[model samples]
Target: MCGADRLVKVAFSGLAPLVIEDVVVEGDLIRVRARTPEVAAACPTCGNVSSRVHGFGLRTVADLPVDERRVVVVVRVRRLVCPTRGCRQTFREQVPDVLERYQRRTGRLARVVGSVVRELAGRPGVRVLSALTICLSFNTALRCLLRLPLPPLVVPRVLGVDDFALRRRHRYATVLIDAMTRRRVDVIPSRSADAVEAWLRAHAGVEVVCRDGSGAYAEAVRRALPGAVQVADRWHIWHNLAKAAGKDVAAHSACWAKHGPPLNDGPLARTTRERWHQVHRLLDQGVGLLECARRLNLGLNTVKRYARVAEPERLVRAPKYRPTLVDPYRDHLRRRRAENPATPIPHLFEEIKTLGYSGSFNLLARYITQGRVEADRLAISPRAVARLLLTKPETLTDTQRTRFDELSTACPEMIDLTNMIRGFADLLHPRPENADRLTEWITSAREADLPHLHAFTRGLDFDRAAITAALTLPHHNGGTEGVNTKTKRIMRQMHGRAGFPLLRHRILLD
Candidate 1:
């Protein structure tokens, strides 16, 4: 092959069906002249063969870059006449693989744009496409994506549904997913039950719906897919229990004050105690939490916590420098133990209680059992006790365990709550005998007279069917949660151009 022919073969080799006739190179632009390789054409309208051409024209089209330079394919297209009777109109021949009619870019170029839009939404996609030297406006890129046909819909047997905030607490949208495949099925505009019901009505065959504890979704499922099994999400159930337990801890604020260390005179401790006292004093005078917070220059939550408790001691924590209850009596206890190595703990406690040992016998027992007392033991608060009960036992440290055991013995209420939390956690990871354990836990909580746990158990009883299915069956809303995360990312990446259709397209297509 000659030098020019070799250049044509090298540059346009990948682009077949359009024979390269001429090649030109300008600064930052590569222009190629090409024509159809076919000698005869079939008339599209009449389905008859035609060799006689009415005219020939040059059509310029953009294509994929060659050697990092922009490529423009100029093709010589022919307009052929239809020979069949009554079909006299002339029609242009089309190179199906190379170009599509009315599209300025090649079919390959459209495919590239489509892929880019699928990966990155409008503005980001435009920037990426521009860097590749195939320039297009943001609007054009989005329009190209919108024109692409949607994937074929397969009705899902197991559907997962969840709601994501469109504008966070203001506007929200619902995302539905195929639970087994973990692929997004559709996105509705709002989280209303009617919207979800309409979607369920449209696509039948949904045997199972895995969703969070949203009343709207529950109602929608009951109305639309009445026969489908609903499985309450494990994460949401745990979350609700946690929130209720937190409220329970907050309600018994007086207990915290009576049990925690006395207020200190240090700057931080003094300020905290003073704020607590001031907020309580104001609230005693019938001041609201918001007004109290504004007056004290503190957060509303802080003010609420302070006002909830009967005294400022509840707000006070053990000071870092201040000696613990064990600290003051440590030397005495040690001296007595050294004097009598075989002394009984009851005799030791009797000796301390007479000498102003206001600390619990449980605390003294732990100190004797551990053989040493650390300063961190003084820092344990009722909130800390609640946290320990809420957390898993395996993750607790030696100090936390000692403190927890002491606190549980001191407060029988805490022991009951701790058992409830642990039993609920066990139910979360259910086994064959979980049903018996659950019934026992429920009966115990009701009889314990703990309002928080009783209310939580009552709520669980209300949703017992769905909650049981969630624990026993292998289905959960984890897939729906994952889809919600993906949907959020798509919306955030879209930036200012977050229209519902574009968000839906990116989610479902990806």
Candidate 2:
């Protein structure tokens, strides 16, 4: 072959075994005319070599882009007659490596499209491919994505399992991961015990399964692989404890509320207190919750909430003030006002504006009119206090530490709750002695007067073995939880247009 011909063959090496005839650029498309090599070809069915050509047929196929332009290849293939005695069948020779059977695109181009669709499914994929000069429709891109094969399932010894919401409250799916490698294993369609149990029964090599506090999962693991060690996730345990501590903090809101400024008498607070009185008055007069809701023109849930609260003070929340330009100069304003209570608003605004305040003069006037400047103390909510109690001491700032200490010493119950939270947090660090520590922690929790902690202790008692394993073993479902988070992002990218099969395909392959 000449130098130009050799270069052509070398440049388009993907079309190996095909003789290049001509290459031309027509408009925006690069069209290549080629022919299959005139060699002996094997019959696909009977596995016999055929040399005699029956005829020649032309096939046009799309290929990868060349110089930001679409490439179309027109190749002349031979139709040979099989030489086998029993099968003298006429068959078309195929270049399997170059193109797939009955497909209009080359294998390499199809693989490129598959990769594009795999990451950006449907409309986004189409838009991206279109931008790259490759023509693709939305449904076509999805079809390409769906055609991609899933990875082979290999059962890992240490498995991590977690569930993510498919539609949130209506539907959910479970994701399994190899804890050691952090690679996703499989995604089950449902988060049911039966679904998990069936999976475990199919793949039997799992020795340690780490999961959350889902009873269905625990039950499934117990039934399917009784010999497997179950490790409860420490994050889930801490989350449950935070929830319980939040309830405990809320129940004793009076203890902390007294330490702060007087209760809010704003319009919202007044409305809440009035509604609570109205709901209770109706309930005391032999009226149903639904009747109270209808008579008061409120939703049933609203009426139920009011009836559930024993005191209206629990319903009143602290004022949540949004940050403003005046916040930076609050200390200056407070100090100036304290020195001279009769300070003029105009004078104060001018002073702060010179001190780098960028707020409008009217905004300063309104802040003073609202009495926020005089009201130096801000009311802390039970949820905020609960967060302080749950947060690690090392992570807390000096201000947060002071607030946490103040809330901790508000009542004897608060003191006990703080100790219990600390004890439970210590058990989260896995050690040989954590099992004993867990036992003592549960005993102390049950002995406390906090009803929320009592319920939390009951959950620990029910899942004792798994909880013990979590406190002792190092296995965790952190990787599985991360997979679930990625699954959520994938679902969001698909925009809920695709079904479980496509979702599973992306979760496993992507």
Candidate 3:
């Protein structure tokens, strides 16, 4: 090959089929002159090969970077005339590998744009491309990504499915994953049974499905793949159990008030207590929170805080010493507490309000809280009890264990509840042999007199088959959750601006 031919071959080595004829470099831009290998151009309209050149045309196309500089391909294309009679047509000769008919960018450059969009997405992808001296706009890059074909679907043997919030507590979408390969299969727009059933029906060969506690997905799987084994996620089960336990502990709120330490005479307690009284006084006088706030010259939020609580004692803060105007009334408050330690703070606040007490309700609340602390040294918080019930005993410190033991003795109902929760936890672990024990635990929970647990057991009974399979089989929705986390990351990176098509492309293709 001669010098010019050598230069042409070297310039267009990777961009096959379109051999380069000349190379020109100016500033940061490199222009390569090229032509198609074929001498006869085919008429796109008539599909007739024509060697008779009707004319010559110049087409500028963007290409991949050449030697750290942006490359622009200037192709000297030939427009040809159709030879067959009555098939009047003249079309440009085409190099399909290098450029499409109307595309401004070469096939290689388009692929580069696609890869960048896949990695960085929209605006970020444009920024990255611009930084590399390859000019691109956010819209162009997004369009390139949107035009990408979908990934080939597979018939996964083990499928994992779950729902993730698109806008949280509002719009939600479902993600399906191949559990065995840990690759996302597809993402559906809705978390409904129809959406999931449609996806399951499109693909076959799913032997087992691991999913969260969504009844919709369970129903979808049951409807679409009756032969496939459905396994409930163990994490969701424990999560539900914890929520139920917390509710059960909260239901015994009176136990906390009765046995809790005295409301401390702290600044927070005094402030809240005063606000509580002010709110109640305004409400009793048929005044709304906004009007009361204006009348008291306080923030609407402060007045609303006061209005939210039913009793002044609920405003009492944790045990802490604080100097307040009610210090002079401490002696009176102590005497009242001694006479009736269990007396509610609202009653005491009222009694003190009649004795020339000009202090706020919070001042009396702090004093009352302190008195309760001194009087009730053995008071246990229901929240603390709830934490103990949820935590494994082996993980507790000595002090925590001692406190837990005291709570169990003080509230025998807690002992029965903990035993039942433990039994349910046991059924969730690697104990396929104990699958039948779940039914027994459900029965005990229904009769345990705890409304929360009864509700939880009812849910377990409704999905008993899936729950049993979860305990028996090794499959779980772990992969589905991981995929959802990845999806969340993508959503955050895109600032949640991505529409469904772009979002799906980023997830499945990338």
Candidate 4:
């Protein structure tokens, strides 16, 4: 070693280097007592080198252990004076063991601390660097990462780009996820064309851009990387289709809701239904039914065809009118109900029939029974309601129609208790002006710029008049919403700590 350098090495080594240094060990660590003066050099800017040192600072810096023990050497550092005229240059000089100009810790020690910061702790390497006696913010930690000598980014074959808004609806960022690897490649600040373009240009070999339908991305890809094939993603297509269908169904919900009763099930009901409708047509046509029925080839025996059957009682049976029963059980039912407030229906049926009531046991009981019973608590068979649902107006006589209207009014709350939200959707469609609050409704839809959603909307936007014809239609986003909900649940299970790596993989892969 050179004379000056050798003296310095020996001073720091306790016995010096290039020769044996007597080493001592401490438990779990080593202590090397070095007395070397800090090295000095000229500031090339000033061309001044001085033996007269500026001032020395002491630090007990960690180093590689002499043997197995950790070696921390207490060292003193120095600065040189610039002797050049017109130069404002007294600067701390660089040294072999120490990092950059005027650094306190050696290069090796700083690196060890930085490594510990990265692997052992998630602390930003630069901020942790302060622990090594250097002061820089966590941003400086980024420099350490950058300093690792990054290789050129290898373009993946297929890249997926999607935007996620982090804070509710306000702040958005782009995630450049890898479709093949199913991992996040990087994140960009915005969905802007420039930002996406910059990313594409930086990674040269990208083959396919898989994206949800978005015009912004399309424009960006065209301008930035024209050669890359852009494939429309599935998620957006389905999402938009669902949205359009939902609106269509919502507006026409009532049409679907009221399909149960067709006004024409049995032959009797069908005839009545057609005749009644024909009567309305006559009224609408400004022609009386007698002439119309002649045109329709109907018999005048039909009550509606008879001009003198004006009073409803002439054509229809009076409701609550009892049958002329030859039933044997009638007298017994009369006795039991008169004596008791509650008579079980089955017992009544049995008692009346055994007494040789001629009318059907069910008919006698149904005719005799009287109470304010909840529809659900009704003792009669449910098949009747199902039958009624399929029944047509023609199957029911004028008397039956009167009875039906009375029963319908008896359960007036059914109309109000029906699916109201569904009703609201219908109201948005073809509902009457008075029934709908059209004055207040803003009919325009607020749509997102997503391409899939846009394409889906195009179908609805095309034939809006047809969709609006009925107030009740059946479109549903239940499945899509359900999928998103399930995704959140999986995320929480993965531990509120999953990175984009896990999230991206789970979604695209699945």
Candidate 5:
């Protein structure tokens, strides 16, 4: 070891321990040329430092990641001998950089391997890490995954609750994500009322909640967050609407299928006999069209048209062409729904097709959802009914307004539903009456429900007041949903291999 003023005494410190003598760095590789500090190690039998280099070799080792640089170090090492003349096998090879025998990298490098693997949860993120650094072994990476931080704690103002299963068609778990922050608030093991209630009650600060139409979530919200406003989410509202339309379509589907083909009046009239039964009976009895229309619930014009059709159109209805296609087997869907209502659609479709249903799934789904519209219509809240009634601007025409105003003044309860519609309108344009009317309507609903309204006073049993407050504020949890989507993307990218801690760091930092 020489220096400018004099040769600086940079002798190695260990008696026989391997020491670094010189170092070089090229890309991610660090080359360290070193040897045993002393010529030999002291023998247990002779207790003397033997002046011998038993053997010497060079080994390459990986190092911890440093900034944009990935690193590996090459170390030159030597084995030392014991001084005893007849000592059996008195020497051993040395290790460098806190590594075990046969280990290709330093301990810190192993930790880094573990850190990425645990953070990402598996190989997906590991592959990304591989592209950035060295191609690490799966086992090595897996060892450090799952060192994830516990998910963050959020005091939820409102929670948008939903569920998804890793594997479809069997198990279900309710997941609660904060409607304001969009962080996953909590996850319950099942859809059970008790589990949902327990979790909801344990956490406070949920003043409002948005949920699907499930009575399960409604009951849980009532039991746990007695003061929380329970409002139906927009997605559920639209879903309910689609379901309603499907039911109407399905109910009359047979009529459509039977009459869809152009037909001669003979067998066509017989097959669609139900469609013109009133006109036929009237004609058979020589009754007039006006009387027949009322009796058969058909339009007078329809009866007249049927009466005048050509004789060829007079026979029983039959397929215009041969019945080449087979009708769908409806029994299997009935069996499936009976056996397990929760089975996913794709699975159910497969099961029914196996049982001889040749119909397209859309048609089958239409049949399955045949009566859904009626059900959805029946389930429409007074609030929704009001919205629909007021949706058209023509409804607010001067003549219409006079009628509506009279209706409102005469039936205040009905007017309250209308007020909600108007409150929603206020969201489109700023108006003072909007807020005043919203508050007034809410107060009215509360006052009307008072005698049986202990909980109502607490602002949980009824939602009008909460809806009014929300209207006044004019804000929503849309941002939260966006954040949730991003969170999912982050999880997908990481592959959930990394433990929660590192995952959190990456998510927050990245």
Candidate 6:
């Protein structure tokens, strides 16, 4: 045999039982003409061996690409007759390894398609396969992906579970991961307690469950695994604390507003203080929040916000000024104006133009008319003060530290809130002593006049066991949270067009 023929045989080795006759390239297509070797074939229906040839037939199938060209294999096979009594059926010879029954592509080629579709899933998979000289439609690629099986389920000793949004507020799903290995186990379609309970009941070997402080999840775990130790995620606990602290800061806006920079006396600030007084007057007269909003021509939420502050001074804030060409030349304008209070507008514009001011005369005239030149320093908002209070003291910059200290010590209530936040933050690190510290912290929080922190303590008391375990145990849902982040990327890549089955499949296999 020629070396070329031997090389062709080796190239088509995946089609083992078929003999290569000729390999020819026509334009961009490579066609291989081959024939199945003569051998006895078993009758599939009757399980009898038959070698008698009944008829000759040709079958064409697509194979892997060769040299960036499409490959088509045409094989000649013989139909054999069954020799068994009363079962003289004519059955075609089969090559199970090279090609599947009734499939038009080689098994090896199908596997390659499955892998590409597994990663990219529909039109993207088709585009990638087409680049490799393999033709496939989007639906065909999705079919290949769906054909792939899921990984086998192995219950982990330490399991972590979390929920992620599918459509945010409308749809959500749950993700389970092995906390020890950080491998994703399953993706449940719904975040309801029944769904989670069903999943936990099926996979029974979990000894410890790490999850966020969702009441539904806690209830499901309690019902599904009565003996399993539940550990609340420390990050979620801190997140809940931060939320309550923000509300507490907002409630005491009157106190922190005094320590912030001087408030603007602009028209907006005047309107704000006027509205606050009007809303409080109506509220003080026994009017409902909605009724006060209707009477004052304001939004209900706006009325509620105004009602939260004790004094109208807290409602006055700094004007949000946009940048202007006159900003850089403010000192020049201010100095020149102060030298001669009666200086004409045109003279100031011309003087600053020589110093590189590129704005119009009307802009400068408007800037002076609006009295922006006399604007005071902007006051800090309650939200910003809340963030400053929650941050660690060592991480603050010099300027930030001064501002934090001033606001934190604005009133007795502010001081108490700051201490409470710091005390709760200290319990996040797991140690045996932290459990007792958490109990004491809750007791102290309830004793304070801070209503927001009182609600926070109530939540901690409701899930005290899980909260205690989280404060004293090392188990956490950090891995599960990371997997949820990855799942979000997958959902974005799929463009929200896929259903739960495809998403579940990718989460398990990818």
Q: Work out the TM-score per prediction.
A: 0.74, 0.82, 0.68, 0.34, 0.41, 0.78
lDDT of 2 by residue, 99-198 (tens): 5678888988899889998888888888989988899788878888888888889999999989998888899999999999998899998999999999
Arrange candidates by lDDT, highest first: which order?
Answer: 2, 6, 3, 1, 5, 4
Segments in model 2 whose C-alpha atoms lie over 4 Å from true places? 1-7, 252-259, 264-379, 495-498
Candidate with best lDDT: 2
What TM-score does model 5 achieve against the real structure?
A: 0.41
Model 4 has how many clashing residue pairs? 33
Give the CA lDDT, 0 to 100, for residue 258 in model 6. 49
Clashes of each: 0, 0, 13, 33, 37, 0
Task: Give the C-alpha miss distance for residue 231 in model 1, angstroms.
Answer: 0.8
- Each candidate: what lDDT? 0.77, 0.86, 0.77, 0.47, 0.52, 0.84
> Per-residue error at 411 for model 4, in Å?
24
Over 102-129, each residue of candidate 1 has an lDDT whose tens digit, in order, gives 8888888889999998889688899998
Q: What TM-score number comes out for model 6?
A: 0.78
In terms of lDDT, the poorest run of 10 residues in model 5 is: 373-382
Candidate 3 lDDT tens digits, 198-259: 98888878989999888898899999999989999999999988888876665544444345
- Order the candidate numbers by TM-score, best to worst: 2, 6, 1, 3, 5, 4
Judged by whole-model lDDT over C-alpha atoms, candidate 3 comes out at 0.77
Q: Which candidate is the best by TM-score?
A: 2
- Better-scoring candidate (lDDT), 4 or 5: 5
lDDT of 1 at 507: 78
**lDDT per residue, candidate 6, 31-96, as tens digits?**
988888888988888888889999999999999998899999999988999898788579888888
Tell me the spans in candidate 6 whose CA falls farther than 4 Å from its real position: 1-18, 36-57, 77-97, 257-379, 495-498
Q: Tell me how candidate 5 scores on lDDT.
A: 0.52
